[model samples]
Target: MYKLSIKKIIRLAAVTLITCSLFSCMSDKSEQSKSFSVQITDKPLTFCNPITLDFGTDRARRAGEAVVAIHQDDYYLFITGLRGYWYSGNMRDWTYVDAPDIPGGCPSVASDGERLIVSGDKSRRDVYASADPKSGVWEKVGYYDREYGDADMFIDDDGRYYMYWGWSQILPFQVVELDPDNGFKEKGKPVTLFFGDYKSHGFERRRPEDVIFSIFSYRDYLPEENPWIEGPWMVKHNGKYYLQYAAIGLELSTYSHGIYVADNPMGPFKYSPHNPLTFKTTGFMVGAGHGSTFHDKNGQLWTIVMIPSFYGGRGSGELALFPTAVDAEGVMHSNTEFGDYPQYYPGIKENAVANNFTGWMLLSNKKYVEVSSTLEGYGPEKAVDEYFLTHWCAATGDPGEYMKVDLGKICDIYAVQVNFDRHDAKLEMGRGFRMPPSLSQYQSYTVEVSGDNENWSMLIDKSNNTVDNRHDYTELAKPVKARYVKLTNVFTHDEGKFAVKDFRIFGNPDVAKFTKVKDIMVVRDPDDPCKAKLLWQPVDGADGYVVRYGIQPDKLYNDYLVYDDYTLDIHSLNRDQEYYFEVEAFDSGTDYFHEKTRQTMGIGAEIELFRDREMLARKMIVEGKNEYVFENIIPGTYQLRHTFGPNMWVGDLTKEQLIGSDNQVTLSEKISDLGVGTKVLGQLNIKVIPGKENGKFVVTLNYDKP
Candidate 1:
C-alpha cells in the first residue's frame, strides 16, 4: 500500500469562533489590476507517468509501493518509493532522511508502537530492524529462502506480525504468520488470499496494452485477460480483516484494490460487496489502486494512493490522499471521483465537516496570463491552465518575480492555491549518488488585494512562515471581497528562479450550474481510431459544454472547455491507452442573450482535428532516452500530426525510419521538399500511395523533437 502516516494526537478543537471581525471589500475600487496564485510542487520529475514518486529536493522521483510507520515523538517516517526515508510532522508534505540499506524495487516497513521491522523487494532474502528509525541505523534481522513475492508487514493489536505478499499474472497473492523475534520467520504456511475471477471482476482486467514499462527496473510483458494482483495489505476493523490488493497497471483510470473480507486472521475470506473499496477511474488522473490506509489524530480513516499518471507512453504514477469512511453497513469507500478537483483538504476535517465545499467555482481558469517576465516557450496562460503537469515560469532567477491575472471582473474571493514548481533545479542542487531527497529551498511572499491598480491591502502574508506546505491552500479568516490581487515574492531560499504551476482562485460569482448530463460513454474516434470521441445527450437548459479528460483521474488538466455541443472530439489522447473524461453543461450568460452566438456554437463547432498542443509527441521513456516508434501504417494521405506553432520542430525520420511488412514512406519537412502536393497545417498531406511491401511504413524518432 502507498499511504503512510505517523501522528501525535493534538486536541485543540473549534475554529469558527466569532472572535475576529468579518471583513468585506470597503475601500477597493470596482475595477482594479491584481494577480492570482496557483499551486505546484517545487520540482517534479516527469516519468512515463512522470509522477511516480516525488523526492523532497524538488526532483520528482518515480516510485512504487511505500509504507508509513510511527516514529519517536509524533513524527511519521515515510519510506520512499526509492531507497531512503522521509520525515514529516504532518503526513501531507515531507523532508528526506538517508539510510544505509540497499534501495531498489518496492520496500515495506511496519511499526509496533515502539520498534520497527522492514524489508526491500530486491532478493526478498532478509528483513531489518531498528529501535529508532529516526536515527536511520537498522541492523539486519535474518535471511529467508522459501519466498516473499512482495513484502508488506502488519502488526496486530495483540503484537502478532503478519506478512502479506505477491505480484504476478500467473500466481495468487498470499499471507502468512511471521515470528517477529526471529526476523519474522514463517510461523505458518502462506495461504493463497486472492486470485480474483477477472471474468466477473471487470476491474481486475489488465490494461488494454501489455505491461510495456520503461521507467522502472522491470519492463515489457505480454498483456492477457487476467490482471496482476500484487501489493497485499491487511487492516482489521470490528473483527473483520480487510484484505486489499492492487489490480491492473496503467489501467488505474479503471484500476482498483480488490477488497476481500475474512472472519479470522487467516482464510475463508469473501469478496466485499464493496470490492475495490478504493476505486476511482475518472477525472484529471487515472488510478487510485496501490496505496496505504491509516487513521489520523482524530481517528478518521484516510488512505494515500498512487495517482495514475501517463505522459508519452510509459506509466509513471504519483500519490495523493483519498478521504475515507466506513458506513453503518461496515463498508469502506475512498471518496476519489472528485479526487483531483479542488476540494477542502483532509487535515482540517477536525475543525470542519466532511463536506466543506462552498460551491465556489474556479474563477480564473484559463484566464489571460500577465507576467513581469517569462522564460522561453513558457507562456503566461500556463499559470491558469489548471493542469498540474504544466507551469508558467519566470525567465530570470530574481526577487520581485510575479504573475498577474485580470479575472475579467470583480468578485468575492474565498481561497487561493499557489502551486510552486522546480525546473532543472537539480543542475544547481548538485546531483550525487544515493542521496536523501528533501526540499531545501522555500518561498516567502506577501499577497495584496486591490480594487484599483494603485490601492492595495495585505490579504494574506507568509513572510515569516517556518513551515513548508507544498499545496498551499489559503482561505481568508473570512470572505474578503476584492477585484485585484498581487503576489510579490520578497525572498526565496535558493536562486530566486520564480516558478508556479497554476494560479487558481475560488470565489462566489454569477456562476453557471454544471448540468450533470446523462448518457456518458467513450468510444474510439470514428475518423481517427487513435483518438476518442465523448458524446452525451445535451442538457435541456444548458447553453454549451466543456469536456475534461486525461490519462489520470486527478490530473485531468487537459481540456476542451469551449465546446458548445453534445459530442466532443479529443485528438490529444494517448493512442496506446484508454482515457477518462468528464462533461459539464454550462449556461455562461454569454450564450443567454446572444442568439446568433448560441446558434453558431455546439455540434457545429466540432473540430476536424485538435492542433498538437504537446511539446513532444507520445513516446516510450527509458532509463536515459525517450523512444518514439510509429507502428502499422496504411497506404493513404499522410501527415506528421504535431504542433505547427512557432519555434517548434520534429526530429528527422529519414535516417531513424524503420519499415516492416509492406510499410513504406518518405520523410520531408514540407510538401515542396517531398516534391508532392500542397502543404496543410505547415506540412504536406502527401499521398502515401502504396509500398512494394504493401501500403504502410513506420518511422522512429530519436533524441528530442526539434
Candidate 2:
C-alpha cells in the first residue's frame, strides 16, 4: 500500500549519486558505446546517534521506549511518557504533534498497510486509530481488558494482528492474536514466549547495585538477582519471525537486546547464538535497548533504540538509530561500532555495516575549559569530561554566564552538541519540571567561534530562540576552522540554574590516526569470572582507546571506552564465557590490535589485607574510595566492610562504633539477620585524614577477594 513519493525519489537519487561515481561510457575496439560504469565508493550518507529531538522534561529530561511505525512511507516516533509523537519523512528531522486524547509511555504502533493504530500507557488499553497521523487526528477504535506493560503491536503480511506484552523479571512475554472486528479482543489464549535465563546468558544477570530504586519497591514485579526480559518487537524477514527483547537492568550501562528466531509470529523460538544482536556499551554514548526496527525510504533496515542517559535519573534516556542487516547466514546484526559518532544515514550506501562511520573525531574532550562562574562542585571541566551524568553549572541563571573551550589547536569544527542540564530545578510535584510541549520557553544562547581567541564571529545565534531543546545539536552548513568556541547564555529557565552537561564539538584534527595500541594485558579475576582487568600502554597523541571484546574473535560486539587511563576494570562480563579482546587506538581515524588470551583467577572464601596505620591519611587502596563530608575534618580510624562485588560497600562506621570490637566487629546486625551478610567476603580498616580541603574525608576500601 506504500507508494514512493517525490521526496523519497529525490533522496534516493541523491544517495545514489553520492555513493556511486558515474564514469564515461566504456570504449571498445568494436566501435560500440557501452553503458556508463558505476563504481561504488566508501562515501556514506551519515547521521549522528542520540538523535536530536525536542525532549520533554519532568524531574529531568525524558524520552525512551521508542516505537517507530511507518504509514504510507512516513515515520512516526512514539516514546514512553511523552505526551505526543513525532513525525518525520527521512527520520532525521522530527516535528512533534500533540494529541491530548492519546495515552503515553511504552507505546506500540502498527500500520495494517493503510491506517496506523496506536496503543500505550500500561493502564489504558484503548486503541486509537489515525488514518492520517501527520494531521494529529485520532478516533477510538478498540480496547483491551487490562494493561500490557512494554507492549508491542505487530501486523503480519497476511494482515493478522498480534499483541505482545510483558515486563517482569519473573514473568515471560505473552502474545495473543487480536480480533479487530471484536473491539480488538483476544482471538485465542495468550501464549507464553520466554523468560530471563541469567544462568545461561551472562548479559542477562542482574546486579543489585544497578537498581534505580529501592529493591523492595519492585519486589512485586521482579525477582531478586534476575534480569527483566521485556520490550518484545517482531520483525519478519525471509519468511521467518525475529523476536527481539531487552534484558539486564535498563539503568545499567550493559543494558542490551537479545534475539530469538521463530517460524511463526507466536513463536516456539530458538535463541540466537549471537544473542545480543545490538549492543554499544562504549564510546561517549551508552546503552542500546528497548527499541523498534523499521525500514527506511529506500528499504534499508534501521533500528531506533533508547540510550540510557541517567542524567535526569535512573529511567532517563535518549534515542539513537543504528543500521541493521541480515547477513548471508540469515543472522541479523546492527552496526554499533563508533555508535555515538557520525554515521551514514539510511540508503546512503550499500553494506552499512562496513562503511558507516564518518571518521569525524571528538575534538573537545578533556580540553581546556573556561567559564564565567562556577558552583561549588560543578567545575567548568565537567562540561567536557565525556560523561553525561556530570555537568558544569553556573552559580546563577543571570545573563552573561558563559562557558568556553579551546580544542588545543585549530581544528575543523563540523558540528557541536550543547547538552543543558537540570541543576537546582524547582518544580511542583513530579510533573513540576516542565519543558514546554509547544516547543517554547527554553534557553536562549549564542555560539561564537574564534581562531585567535580575541576575534570572534557568530556561528550559531539562537539569542531569541523559543524551542525547548535541552540536548541541542547543530551540523554546520560547512566545516569551520577554529580552536576557540564559546557559548554565551542569554536566558535560562527560571526554575533551574545554568548548567551544561557536555559541550561536545566534533570534527577532524587534520592529523593521522594513532597507531595500533600495543602491549596489552588482560587478567580475569579468579574469584569472579565476570570481572576482568585490562592494562595497555598509552598511545601517544591518541584521544582515547576502545577495548572491544566478545565470545569469539570474529564477533567482538562489546566495546568499552577508556580515556587517559592505562588500566580498565571490566565488571560486565559473563561468568562462564571465553572472551576475545582487541584494543583500538583512535583519534580522527582508527587503528586496531586484534589479540586473544584466556586468563583466570581463583576465588577464596575469605582474604585479608593490611595497610600502614600511620600513613592512613596519605595511603589508600587501589580499588575504590568513599568520600564523606562533615562540618570539620574527622581524624579517626573508620571500620568499613568491603564486599566482593564492584564498588560494593557493606557498612560505614566511625571510631566510636569500632571502639569495643576488634577486626570482627559487629556494626549493624540488620544486614546479618537478613542472611545476606555472607557476601561481605572481607573488611577494610580505613583511617580518614584531612582531604585536600577541610571538612572533607576520603576512605578508600580495597577488596580482599578480587
Lowest lDDT sum, 10 consecutive residues, model 2, at 16-25
For each candidate, give its TM-score against the true structure.
0.59, 0.72
Worst 10 residues of 1 by lDDT: 13-22
What are the clashing pairs of model 2? 45-344, 45-345, 46-343, 46-344, 46-345, 81-105, 428-432, 526-601, 526-602
Q: Residue 541 of model 2: what lDDT?
A: 65
Best by TM-score: 2
Number of backbone-clashing residue pairs for each candidate, in the order shown: 44, 9
